[model samples]
Target: MMHQPMKHNRPPMMKRIADASEPYLYSAPALILIVAVMLVPLVVGISYAFRDIQLLNPFSGGFVGLDHFRALGQDQAFYGALRNTLWWTGASVFLQFTFGLILALLLDKPFYGRGLVQALVFLPWAVPSFLAGLNWAWLFNPVIGPLPHWFYALGLMDEPHNILSDPHLAMWGPIAANVWWGIPFFAITLLAALQAIPRDLYEAASIDGAGPVQRFWSITLPFLAPTIAITVLLRTVWISNFADLIVVMTNGGPADRTQIVASYIFTQAFKRLDFGYASAIALVLLALLLVYSMLIVLLRQTMLNKG
Candidate 1:
């Protein structure tokens, strides 16, 4: 009597290929939709950046070289728009991350009414941007506005403060509005990350006689570093293009001190009816955004490597 040899059993490579192909069998439609809807529009915008587009008719425009970008080099308004855009990006992102982190840290602690406070704090994010902007726009109304009334009551103003017209305050006002509208989103997102942290780590730190600050520096921040980096990246992108809030609130008035790149581009294209020039502005903005996005990816990778 002899034991029979076991037969080797394995699917052929061709069968494996057929199995993998099954998933793509249903993905073709989605692929088509993505290409047609997203890729086509992006390609068209990129193409226009190289053309002499007109407001009257985009198709009738002729091809132009890099004159648009070259023109931007000599334009003062473009420079102003760039400066304001930088200010907006820097201030809004910094404030959003700072406040959001504070809220997240506070909410991370155990307290009564924690759930209610979190839900209430996140309410600003639920409302639409335009609506929130409009609400702030009204609150700053010079004569009848609550802001002016409160300032007067507190002896902070001899007269009503013209928020929209004051060069010093105009930009900050919009920044405040945007931060208010944006904070809750960051809070909720960061809170989720905080909650995902392991309790055992904290317990171990406590057992080692670590103080609140020591435990936070060693355990908390390191764990939340990735989340903070991601939040900064996302907030940067959104805050950079925050035009609806600005436009609805101030329309970039008072000698255009508060005009951001997006609103400037809008005014140039739609208000001035100079589509070619506006396209150039838009192309420049696109370039900056691309650079920022790349920087974000690099920073994220660096942070990830560190942790």
Candidate 2:
């Protein structure tokens, strides 16, 4: 009995061990690499908030705890940046989701060249953000801009000059550009959600004499609610930190009216050479993004639990 105990188990033992954890081991390298790359820069940037650094001494700076945060509190630019960021996040996400939902619902029905039309609508989002900004810049040009030309040609405006320079529309110009840039993403996501919805629900509703309006209000929208809410949260997070369009289009210009948190932090740190203060501002932005994301996650989880 004792001699038979070992039982030549090495092959089966090796197979069992491999089967149990080889997948996790295979994934370990990528997980570590991602964590190091992402977390290191984030930690370094956050640490700078406690220091009093400037471009003149980028390599070394003194610790000045909370000073930068204090400075940012009194900075009018901070408040302006915050205001514009809220406007960007709220207005762009709202309009983008609205139009996207409409486009998705329409496209959900069978039609000719539907694929082509959807692709065409999505084309604006396919272009690089910087290029989109440049195109918008030209479109808003006062003298020879296409939009002003069309507008003035149609007798819509008094001038054919730069519309972005107009105080009334300058900030809005970026929002519209951002919205256009953002719409396709929402459409694609919502369309995928719409397509996944059970067709029998619609037929049942129709058989019950539910009109198009009633069906949509009752079935279509409720099914889409979770997806829409998540997308809005994500879009808000994205626009809050999106600096490229604002940078290339307006440079947060025309007197800093278009300045958002990201661009402002960039200006304070690199442009103004106030590293510490910029870090402080960046931390605030990070905190804001954290709050937004947490709320989205918690709400989504709650909804899922309720369901």
Candidate 3:
């Protein structure tokens, strides 16, 4: 064969391998940190669900298998917590989404002092959860706050009494606080999605003699369906797990009327020193959330297919 031109020297195979792996090497620390911080704790927590892990017990490391689950099945307090969780999550997500949609719609229109209005409305979301709970608790108090007085004046209540003391209404105290703080989150997210919709679609719909309601039903609703679905799902999960307000405001008091599963878990873990039982309850909650999320996703897929 004719003398071939000498091939240019290339990097050694080991060097090439090292070069290809350099990016991964750079990211290795963060990857290790995530595994150490998140994955390790998650695995440990799941393991704890199956073991006797009382915090104060010296000899509580034995694997008990499904014992905690069996006890949980017979626990009436857990059942009550489950029901309260449903009520709390349902009311909070509904009211937040409703008022948030309204706020987003209102803010979508150009107006004077729009920025100021938006900032004021979103202020509650910026407040710390503990502070928000305290603020709302105070507001519900008749001693220094005006809400009870307002309710009394409106004849909703016979006297200016704190609703947090009433078992029937204690859940509503945290729910109201949750709704106020969470509304801004939904408003911000939905407003962003609203702004992303093509203005031309609305213009075209208007040209076709579509009124506001018709335009909303025909164009706006469909565009917002995906965002609304995702937001509602996320908010449902978050509100279900949110125990800060309940803990700070009521501590699941009024005879445990305000106790949701999350606060119940807290009660089990810290108050009762039953870490294993708390982990079991958390595992159950996680399973329920997974199932609920799956159902929602399937429903969304089916609706999209039909549409």
**Model 3, which residues run further than 4 Å from truth?**
1-35
lDDT of 2 by residue, 47-138 (tens): 88998778797566878888888888899989999999998778988898889888898889999999899889999989999988888887
Candidate 3: pairs in clash: none
Model 1 stretches astray by more than 4 angstroms: 1-10, 18-34
lDDT of 2: 0.85
- Over 143-256, each residue of candidate 1 has an lDDT whose tens digit, in order, gives 666897787789877887867778877887788888898888788888889889999999998998999999989988888888887778777877787788888888887778
- Reference-based TM-score, model 3: 0.88
Give the alpha carbon lDDT tens digit for every residue of 1-307 in model 3.
1254536566568867887999999999999999999999989999999999998899998999999999999999999999999999999999999999999999999999999999999999999998999999999999999999999999999999999999999999999999989999999999999999999999998998999999999888899999999999988998899999999999998998999999999989999999999999999999999999999999999999999
Q: How many residue pairs clash in each candidate?
A: 0, 3, 0
Residue 64, model 1, lDDT: 85
Best-fitting candidate, measured by lDDT? 3
Q: What is the lDDT of candidate 1?
A: 0.83
* lDDT ranking of the models: 3, 2, 1
User: Clashing pairs in model 1?
Assistant: none
Residue 208 shift from truth in candidate 2, angstroms: 2.7
lDDT of each: 0.83, 0.85, 0.95
